[model samples]
Target: MLSTSEMTPETIEQEKLYLDLGLSEAEYVRVKQILQRRPNFTETGIFSVMWSEHCSYKTSKPLLKKFPSTAPHVLQGPGEGAGVVDIGDGMAVVFKIESHNHPSAVEPYQGAATGVGGIIRDVFSIGARPVALMNSLRFGNPGTGNVNHLFQEVVRGIAGYGNCVGIPTVGGEVQFDNSYEDNPLVNAMCVGLIRHEDMQKGIASGVGNTVMYAGAPTGRDGIHGATFASGDLTDDSDKDRPSVQVGDPFMEKLLIEACLEAIQSDALVGMQDMGAAGLTSSASEMASKAGTGMIMNLDLVPKREANMSAYELMLSESQERMLLVVEKGREQEIMDIFAKYGLEAAAVGEVTENTSFRLLQHGTTVADIPVDALAEEAPVYHMPSKEAAYVKAFQQMDERIPEVNDHADMLKQLLQQPTIASKEYVYDQYDSMVQTNTVVTPGSDAAVIRIKGTDKALAITTDCNSRYLHLDPETGGKTVVAEAARNIVCSGAQPLGLTDGLNYGNPTNPEVFWQMEKSVEGMSAAAKMLETPVISGNVSLYNQSNGKSIYPTPVVGMVGLASLEDITPSFFQETDDLVYVIGEAKPEFGGSELQKVVSGKYEGKAPGIDLQVEADRQQQLLRGIQAGLIQSAHDLSEGGLAIALAESVFTGKGLGVEVDLAGDATVALFSETQSRFLVTVRPEHKEDFETTVDNAVHIGLVTNNDTLLVRVNGTTKIEEDVSTLHQLWKGAIPCMLNRKA
Candidate 1:
């Protein structure tokens, strides 16, 4: 272990553990020159860490300016704790996604729990009542003990916090592979509801305004968190576990109520949560956004432990904490409300007119930095682009045919695969019914929630299958976009806009660069076809561990517009409707589940894309549903048509059907044909539904008897009771979990 005396600048610099601060060679020299006039501790490691890329967005800040965050319907956007959009009728929706990659790699459970905790606070910080929560998690294969432990712990962590906080974990996606073994990516998103006029901004103004700290007391935990996030994890990260903050959902629960109540009383001017960078970031940003300054007295801060240093108080990422800017006279009211909840509230600072951030301890100045230079300015880089080599390689591949024996068993095994199985166990722990706005819950193509007053509702879904993208980026990317849009269409919604979280390996490598280029091009092409533009997004690089990188994962978070009248839930109704397969299923078995199960390999190419046809199909499906011609709809995705049919039956009241296919066995069962939807229509409207789409095919009808049968070329190829099929489908997940040992 290194001693305090030996923890000098040279040693720390050698570790490459300091924030870049977005400083140029000359600007850095200038900062050093200015620091020479300050005390020793003023130029210490904590200060530098707080000013780094993870905290300051030194690299991404410039590029984020190009996003269209604000629209006529947007109540609030960038610079706030979370973005708020006007959902109409005096109501607004607050939503945002944040990354917790480095910390999760260091300590999976606590890291993931705190990530959920932090994002919830972000939504509630702006006076919004958090209603829904979601996460997009990527990890290594679960067959390994360590990876399995991480996966289980991370899932439990999300459940523990979100469930306790009474916020429902509505929807999310999980991907497993070798690349994320050591460097897992855990991105959490939160959505909340608030009145449009009551939304709060985290800004500090007025020379006499009082600055207060509420919730938990400051501690040494999570020191230099921003710097820790920016650096690559190594074998020594086990020693840094203490740097990961601990979460307390009980305290967060109380804080949420207190903050929301305080905002309503007009006693608060600005508010922000002390996440990642803690007090330093919250206070500096609040003041900077208001074009003002602040002077924080470290000695006056409420601390959990005695004798805390000024730097520790500023940089600590202790959970359940928030900073507030209150008018001078209303400080007592704000303090009383927090005190009643048995929470600590202290006036540790005061807003200043001078445009500089000042820190004070024991009535003596510790550090002073210009607010404009430190808060608003961070470096942003437009990275160089390159052509992906895999694109051409996949385009040159020849399709190979796979021999099928007992296609029924093949379908059962594919549905049982961990990736394609039901995630009910995970979502059951979430409070998805909290706000009473959810129209359709988990285990669906997309989640639909009412917009409260209007006849309009919103449909949200997150999708991506990186394995396909890994095999063929362009097609994989296009499929993801197409599938997400199809999911919305299945719910009777028109695709609106998209937000992507691009997870990739080191971009400096040519192979990784190619993946990025192809994925983006594919996404762009699909987005144009769907008529949805990329709005807000995040890019996460360096997602590799143990010398291996994860597949190019560009998880798409899509939002669509839907009318309340035409909303179609994922589950089918009673047994009298006709079930139809709406698109052609071709015998293109590249990169398919049949290949994985039969061959134990992943070398085949992914499905191809026909943009025009997909777009037309989407529009036709929406028209059909809106006209009340289609009763229910579900998109065909993972595990192909067989799995889609299985899930549809499982969700319905009962399964009753016999599928008669006009195609080959493999093509009829396992082919993941895009733009295809399984729909249920009343026998009377069957003709209208058939004519709604140009290429619709009626394959079967719902039945009262609990049996599923498949007929291929006039032969009964597969038959099973509904209960047995359900057992097989549900058992797949637990079986895979038990196999981990």
Candidate 2:
């Protein structure tokens, strides 16, 4: 690893080749002309990076402007650090999902861990108490040793930070594929709770406002994160690992408490977390948004090392730091508060009268660029687009209908696929008990938490199965969206909004681009059907390595509204309740679990979508549960009806189920059908629930005996005690360890 001191002028020039730098002849002439009006290189780079499409909303900004972020229930949205939704009674919830794809691809563990740490700050920087943390991780298949190392390290990194910070890692999505072997995507989502009045913004106003640097001291780590993220990964990306910051969760925990306390004291006017673009980007953005100017003496910034260059000090993506525009006289008070936590704090600069960003290093001016020119005028380009040609893989008819001599043993084997098995091993590493606000934790379909002091609760979940998407982008995307919404609805919540992290391979490839286009269309259609607008999302492209790309993975993070009185957790409480399927299940075996279990081939087109059916079923189920007509609900996914039934039984108070599928044995058991839900309704309300839901089918009744008996076409396929079922489901993924090469 190269030290920061070794980064000479020649090294800086060498690094420039990896980024576009946006310094075209025409752009340079335009910038110079603007500089003729006023000149500053540091300010120019800050503005350029912040307003760049990667930082600024130049391209997507105009489009995102159309979203309904500020509804009647919205306490804050868009321009703020994170979106805040009013949860009634002066309480609100803040949530946002961000991508750190480029960095994580270079250095998986630290890159991912720091990504989590950064987003957590984004929440608490706004005076909110981060309640939960979730990550959507996409990587290349772990069949290869190196890929396995990256996967294990990334998981450990997320676990390490989340656990250390005392925030529960409630839920998330993980997928493996070839495209991501080299360039993985690590997108983290954080949700915070705060009082409506406590919410803060990233604006620096009032000429006398003092700008303070709080948290860890400046370092050379992640010097050009924004530019790094905006570039494509190549075989030489290992050399770019220095651009990924090393995380310090201990420092971050202290920072979170100190910042929240500082905001509570009414000493700070505005605040912003030092993420991606770090100091230069955060300060310039705060000033630009406030329509004011800022004058910074970089020399005053507390540093971990001596003799730092102006650029190094300005753009360093140092972890766990924040920029705060304090009310002049209260700077010392805030500094004292941070100091009590053993964290560093210093007054770096002041808000200025002129609308330009100014920097003085060692009392000498280095750069002074116009705020708007640098912050809002970065270039935006529309890339070339093309359609992907569909080519079906070679199919073997004989392997499709494998002889299952022992149906019970085959079901056990199928349950053991890593994708369908319990994620206890991973969830166990997380601190799911942190804030005492977690209403529903990891094992449930969706995690629910109370909105502090309010009668309302919020349900959240992230969902995606990339293997299905790689086989069929359109259907796979739609199914995942529906599944996420279904999970939330199963908890008796009305779906509110969505945040998507679209992870894909190199866009330069026509085939990958085609997958992306199709996936987006699928997601758009699903969102429309569900009436859930995507409020915030991220696009992660070029998730490829060594000339191979992973499957198209568009991870959907959804939030929904539920009153405390109506919350229905996924666990079944009564043994005698009737189990029902909310919608009809068809024999959609295109990309079914049956295909993976019967034949080792994992390629095939996913199931088709019936948007109307899905929407109607979801709506009916939500109404029934909210009306207290049902107690338990779970969505069908991964291993389909059989797995769904098994999971419901495994979590029930006592599981004895007798179900008869009115279809073919294999098709009725393991088909990857959509728009289906397994719900347990009271014996008396079972009839009413069926009537309420348009096409709900009463499959069986839960019994006192802890055994699961599934009869298909008069054949008893699975007969296992609840204890055995639980053991099998929980041990499924662990069993895959035996198959690991």
The 10-residue segment with the lowest total lDDT in model 1: 15-24
Lowest-lDDT window of 10 residues in candidate 2? 391-400
| Candidate 1, residue 672: how far the Cα is off, in Å | 2.4
**Candidate 1 overall lDDT versus native:** 0.76
> Each prediction's Cα lDDT score?
0.76, 0.77
lDDT of 2 by residue, 113-176 (tens): 9989988988887789998988777766455667667777788889999999888888776655
Error (Å) of candidate 2 at residue 302 is 0.9
TM for candidate 1 is 0.90
How would you encode candidate 1's per-residue C-alpha lDDT over 1-741 as one tens digit per residue? 554445454654454323342233444444555555322344444345545656665444444453445446656655677777665568766776777777788888888899999988888988898877878888776666787778778888888888888777878877665667788888887877788777888899788899999999988888777766765577787877867988999899999988888888777898999987799889888888899999888888889888887767877889999999999988899999898888878898899999788898888877787766566754344455565566567557777657778877777777676677677656776677777788878778888888776788777788888878888887888988888899999999887666667777766566776677778778878877777655545666666655577788888777776889999976667678888887888766666767777777665578777989999989998999999988889988766778777777885466667778866877887787677888888899988887787788888878778888888999887787777888877776555666746
lDDT of 2 at 459: 91
TM of each candidate vs. truth: 0.90, 0.90
